[model samples]
Target: MKKVFGILFVAGMVAFASCTSATEATEDAAAAVDSAATAVDSAATAVVDSAATVVDSAAAAVK
Candidate 1:
């Protein structure tokens, strides 16, 4: 998955570099990195939240 993401990022960079100005490419790359980071954080948060919920439910069932 990470490899795929890296490939996509690199592909996007190449495409942007070919088509747009450096300043625009830089801005877009930065924005894409930020968006990807946020998405990872949200996915991690969701996984943690889901695990906690499962654990809580198990504990409740035991009691």
Candidate 2:
């Protein structure tokens, strides 16, 4: 009975540790995804700004 209790205790500890690590991994992945989205937004804004500048230059040339 003592041996059985010891084995169960060890198994429970391992399960709890695994669950904690899995949760941390999920959080890290979410953070990385958010960072990637911000980079994409910045790039899109730069492209739009460049297009507006080109349009302004063409208008000035016509004048």
Span of 10 residues, lowest total lDDT, candidate 2: 16-25
Lowest lDDT block of 10, candidate 1:
16-25
lDDT for 19 (candidate 1)? 78
Model 1, 1-63: lDDT tens per residue? Answer: 999999999999999889765797899999999999999999999999999999999999999
In candidate 1, residue 46 scores what lDDT?
100
Q: Report lDDT per candidate.
A: 0.96, 0.96
Clashing pairs in 2: none
The clash number for model 1 is 0
Q: lDDT tens digits, residues 1-63, model 2? A: 999999999999999988765777899999999999999999999999999999999999999
Alpha carbon deviation, residue 37, candidate 1 (Å):
0.9
Residue 40 in candidate 1, Cα distance off native in Å:
1.0
Output the lDDT of residue 26, model 1. Answer: 91
Runs in model 1 deviating more than 4 A are 1-21
